[model samples]
Target: MKPRFPIPLLVPLLLSVALAADDDFSFDFITHGPMLGEVTDSTVKVWARSQRPGEYAVRYGTDPASLDQVSAPLKTTIEHDNTGWVTLTGLKPETTYHYQVYHDTLPTGPAGGFRTLPNAEEHREPEHNPRGLFNFSFQFGSCANQNPNHGIGPSLPTHATMRRTLPGKALFSIMNGDFIYEEHRTLPVTNWLSQVGLTPGESPEIVKLAPSVVGLWENYKTYLSRGVNLAAWQRNMPTVFTFDDHELVNDIRGAGTTGFRERRAVFRDIGIRAWEDYAGWACPRATSQGIHFGTAKLEEGSDILTDKDADFSKIDLAQAANLHVHWGTDSAGVDDIRLDAESPANPNAGVYDVLEVLDAHRLRVTPAAVADSTGSYSIGRRSHGKFTVSNCDFFLLDCKTHRQMHDPKEPGKKGLTLLGDRQKAWLLEEMEKSGADFFFVVSSVNFMIPHNGAGGHEFAEGKDEAWTSMLDERERLIDAFDALRKPVFILTADLHNSFAIKITDRVWEFASGPLNSVNHVPKNDEGDRPATGLFRSGPRTCDIRWSSYILPDLERLQRLYPYYCVAQINNVFNMPKELGGTRWVAYPNPQVIFQYFDGRTGAFQYAEAIGTERKP
Candidate 1:
């Protein structure tokens, strides 16, 4: 197949980076990344892919000159897409460490550095230790669709803007999905005029299908190699990832893509495998084994798994529980109780031999209490997770993997779910127990504010992609968040424009626009219109305090300025008692400032401060 975009210029440009004299190591150098992954107190994972099969290592230290530490050389193979991670361990906490990737004795790319988060030992009561609660910011955005043949350019200017604007201040970035739109060899008729300067097969980049990993790897490399800004930012900052639909297929569900229902399992398995090798390895997961069991309950004294909304057909029975199964709490803090299902003794409450999958929804297993039996019912892996830095906690939800196909007709269906059972339970439990002052929940899709109108608007005919589709589950999750009473900010993307909706007194949803994709303006009948209490979805029944969009008009929307959001936690501000009052007092209240910046010009566009209450 043809290359996704014209990349002939990129080939020699990347090839020139390997300056070492050795023919074996110099020629086969780093292709895509030195992308920083999870940066803990004492360790950091650096992900890189070679141009070909080779061994690589990371040389690092707090001082760039000395560079004493070196990671164990990891080999990159075509089987794993020639990508591997080199973890630098035994580093000091809260210290900045500079590092460079090496193909044997040769330097692959320019040196990049990242600062580790404060250690757990540094966390203490603010009253006892003044410096215990540290303040920091993080950059986040989604839908960096790099379909170069389309109207969008190969250069992801947003990434460059994010790196230059935020510099080294932002702790990390959360690339909440749609990192790549795996659509190759497809172009629009309108975009045909834009392809005049490009030649077919101009670059050596090949698109191979069958194995799926090859094409996906090519897709990542195509995008990464095309954009210098994206590659540069990735190399410098540590990024946590959670995928949306595009990583697998456009608007994919658990069942499958609408037309290709038969290939659901293959798509999910291959998509996730490629994602794991490229993205998921960076952050840890709460449930990293199989798909978390959904609709777990005791029906008439029998343990039954009936998730009517989910498509169990997508489960790979081969690499499933039969190989190995683990049960217990969904918390990332606790170790899962591993059970050998292949054992003849059937020690796992008779789960080895007689585990019956009735259909897409219903399954029969050994009878047990609902709380005691929390394991994956299908082939699910690391999709959702919980992580913490200083005083802020993060919950990254996997919106696509366990998602049910949303029906526009029945918006309030009983079983329609966005986050499946075990994940929801874990999120609620973790939120309740969290001691952090701020919570940043990463949901790749939008939380509320239905993009499609509720009534019979022409544009709203079959749209049910956002939280509006799963009203019941969304409300329940919101209520759980409301009960926390702390400042909970839901960071979301997938929508092509940036907006913020104050969902409740303590809960807010801040969605950033696409990093490089076209800026999509919602229709006239779409989004929340504050003038009337009614929105496109319905009456604004929820306690939404305020709502605002960065590009509210078509004129500004046409500018196509890429966007990203930065949330500054534990910020202080002064405010007045009355509306637009001059007699102001020092608020000194702990707050989170949601700041938006234009990805093209790096200009600060908007800012909103939440959590101004005097007490926690």
Candidate 2:
């Protein structure tokens, strides 16, 4: 029997890396992780961070005793905050492999192993069946902040529970979003005083101002080290992460027009860079290149471009920032500033790059002719992406980027965008082309449900952060799913409660976790269909299957408990043989069973099943 690893009460800093005096911040030598990611039939990426620059490698094999295979040594540099990944390849499909990390000659963390996904081709057979069915299971949830002041727990207990309960059964964990929330605003560091390890009432002047990059790095380091349970879970189970607002800043809308363009520009470049170092290296990227673009209104008749709040070309574009720009024509001229790579006038047309950073905010570009007036200036580049597993395609939508400010009155207008035109198109095309048995669309925010009653079930009013504000895009995506006639599971998070809503006969939406975030009371006004309980919430457009929030006295009932949804998928549904029958019959219909469990008591809170019926 495999020995059960004990959960540590306090998260120990990994090993010493670098040290700073002001905040007394330091990174461990083998800091935080030797976690797994990007696991496929024959490949898995092992990611780890170090306090110092050095070459690191991983030893692996099917047996824990022999552990014969060794990966090529990869170097960790201070440039990337001493983080990197070494991918192990030539692995056997559907086989389990054990691994141990090496800091040069010495082994680092505990031994860990994971089972590779089944080969896609293996599902087919000539004798028993021509088309084979793929089967697998995974657990998913989101919104975990290990900060005590946030009213969430000091550590992620749910991950420990998942690691304990699921064991070798779950293929990988899907961290839908909000992996870290400690990196709040940095213009002046709004929430710095409340951060852990800070002196009480530390003078704002004494606190070092961290650039978005450093700030994000510090948060990841702190969260990973402090997240003892999360650390324990990731060592064995790979996690696919997508970003929500908190990953960048609280309630960030990458493409929204309302925020300060300068800050958005800074966050995009820094945040993406930090995310790549910490999370993106292991995940598949969107075809759109994870590019996030937005337009800023230009000053009229003035050569200097300025919005109601910011000056164009003044947003800080970091070194190594890959950015493109398209200057728009007058509003009356109907500027063709759309992100059309085919249009010569469009910056994304691939002609001009951000020439040079004159300073922090000001930039220099060629064809100086137009430091002149314009309607709007569009700027964007590659950002976050998605991944897949087995015959299931996981389209983890880049919700943070490419979102536009929605007009509640004209919700269906072209201007209202959540998954920008490019991403939406990519999704539809991919879904249409995929031969997968199921499609799991992961959105960091609730898809069709509202968080508050302010907009009365449809719009969240001023908050463009949630899908409730992007009703038009929601409908369009739903239509696309309905057309496919496949089993589409829209798994969502960030609302801080678990919910299940049936959008159609073949499509459903499951909002999963808070993992460890503060409690957000579910409300009847959040949606149209209340599941006949205290905290039920679901869209009126469809029936709600179940809502964990609906339990009586929900707020006081289980406030500290974290939650998760484990989903099992199978290609066939079996009908037991009747009393006189000789054998059971198998239907090609793919079925998915979702089990929601509370972390505190390991109690089963709810379960729901859905499947695509095989045609007669």
Candidate 3:
């Protein structure tokens, strides 16, 4: 039996590479590695970060033995938090090549390799191609909590094992979101603060240290940098990213509690930046090349990406510093200018210009309207390009940023939406055009069950909390999707448990992982999904006590609800399967495994997967 390697998360100082880390800090592939971006036969983009400000570049070629070739140096500045991406151009089509990160023209890190995607015009005829059959499978799962959750017991071994050895093979993977848990606005949202090493006061040191309005981003930046799970995966398999609630401060809706849009604005900007800073380069099609990051168009009201819009050339440091709450004001000062401006009389529409002001410090904010003011756009400083795997193509959607809700009391309100106008249109447009053998839609939220809280039968999780909450919008998308009638598989993360829903033979949704958090139980069987962890089985409901650290999913449930049998994985990990070349996550044998569903319905056309598509 091989050992299951659980990645130890980083310390506070490490740029919380996961929310659990900071963004865009690839320095000569120091912490992570040649995370891939767009790929064509002749060109590809690679994203990496400098732990500190410095010069960076990549040396690549078709030959692993001789990678004497090098690209121009990408200088990372402290202003961009030392994150730099490099695009490698001039290469033959459909080829495998090696690359290494270099500092000052000296070898700085391990050499990584990638194969250029097949040309679009080239058909996958075995006679014409050496790459036989051209069949490839990518792995995906979510909800890996790096910080140990003391629920049921000190995090389940099943979840932890999955986190360390997900996809097991070196195939490409997508971390659909909730890669880390920020399930609370402040620290100590759960009772396991001491256990997780998080210090908690009304405002912890982290809280005290973050910028006033957008403090959460800084908080996540610290924690995400520490995520060893994501870092490890990125080092090897090219993992794509998107966000769910935990990436922010848990279920952060478009509307805030104080009736001010500032919370929404601040959280929105923070989430986007956090994604850009840490997860930006996961997909290059959206991040590295475009001036406009998201699917939403400027005319149809898409949210603007700050790094895309932030023009420091127009402002000075003094102004930049003043825009930040922590840098500009006292602890008890005004953190938000939106609340004051949005009032009928104040109508501070452009008084402070949050978008322009936030740009000063490299922070970003989009106006509720006016996403485009400066006419032309530029794709500056891209390292990689669109995310690609050989013979397979996928489109990742950012789910969380543009959710506008309706009054829950009135479910049928006409304009109630989950995916905003621009993004929804883009998804439909892409689906109609793509010709890949398989079509995959990725998100972080679970679209399987109704918007339930604590695993109960509550169909609505507040006003548009989960996708099901928005009645009209989800239905419309479902109708359009059903019409497409292709083999559309949705891969996603977000829930603690594992699930699947077959909307149609054309559409199959598979959800795997809580990774490092509380392994989920059959929904509605347990009392409630706890704030931090899950509840134990019946008779021992709501137990947050830690018995043993190593928990196999089978032992805890007695009867396997999803039946992730032990035959595939024993107590030890990394073992090879009897199938000679393949490996198993649990179950053994070729018996097609189809367990009974928990009878949940209407999750994205009776399938599963909540969603978020983070920028590359």
The digit string of per-residue lDDT tens for model 1 on 475-551 reads: 88888888887888999877666777777788888888778776554553245445223344332254433333433
- Identify the superior model by lDDT, candidate 1 or candidate 2: 1
Candidate ordering by TM-score (highest first): 2, 1, 3
Model 2 lDDT tens row, 334-425: 11213211222322211124555444334444323232333224344434455666457888787765676556455446557777666777
Model 1 lowest lDDT segment of ten: 328-337
The per-residue C-alpha lDDT of model 2 at residue 561 equals: 51
List candidate 3 stretches off by more than 4 Å.
Answer: 1-44, 61-66, 91-98, 109-133, 150-170, 183-225, 255-265, 285-393, 406-413, 454-464, 521-616
Tens digits of per-residue lDDT for model 3 on 1-616? Answer: 6434334534432445353332333323454444665445577667665555677788887677788788877665433345567678877665677787877656765667766544433433333333322323344556555444312222334333433443432245566676555432333323323322334553332223332323333344444355543444454455567767666545555421112233332244334444565665556443222222111113214333344434555543221211111111222112232332332211211211234433432433344433343221111121112243442346676665455544656554577655656557767887777654345667565443343443332224333354545657755765676677555555555545555555544454556554455544433322233322334321222222111122234444332221111101011112244645422122121111212122111011122222211225
Question: Regarding lDDT, does 2 or 3 come out ahead?
Answer: 2
Name model 1 segments beyond 4 Å from true.
1-23, 26-28, 119-131, 148-152, 185-210, 256-266, 290-378, 453-461, 524-559, 571-589, 612-616
The alpha-carbon root-mean-square deviation between model 3 and the true structure, to one decimal in Å, is 15.5
Of the two candidates 2 and 3, the one with more favorable TM-score, higher being better, is 2
Angstrom error of the Cα, residue 343, model 3: value is: 15
Question: Who wins the TM-score comparison?
Answer: 2
- The C-alpha local distance difference test score for the whole of candidate 2 amounts to 0.63
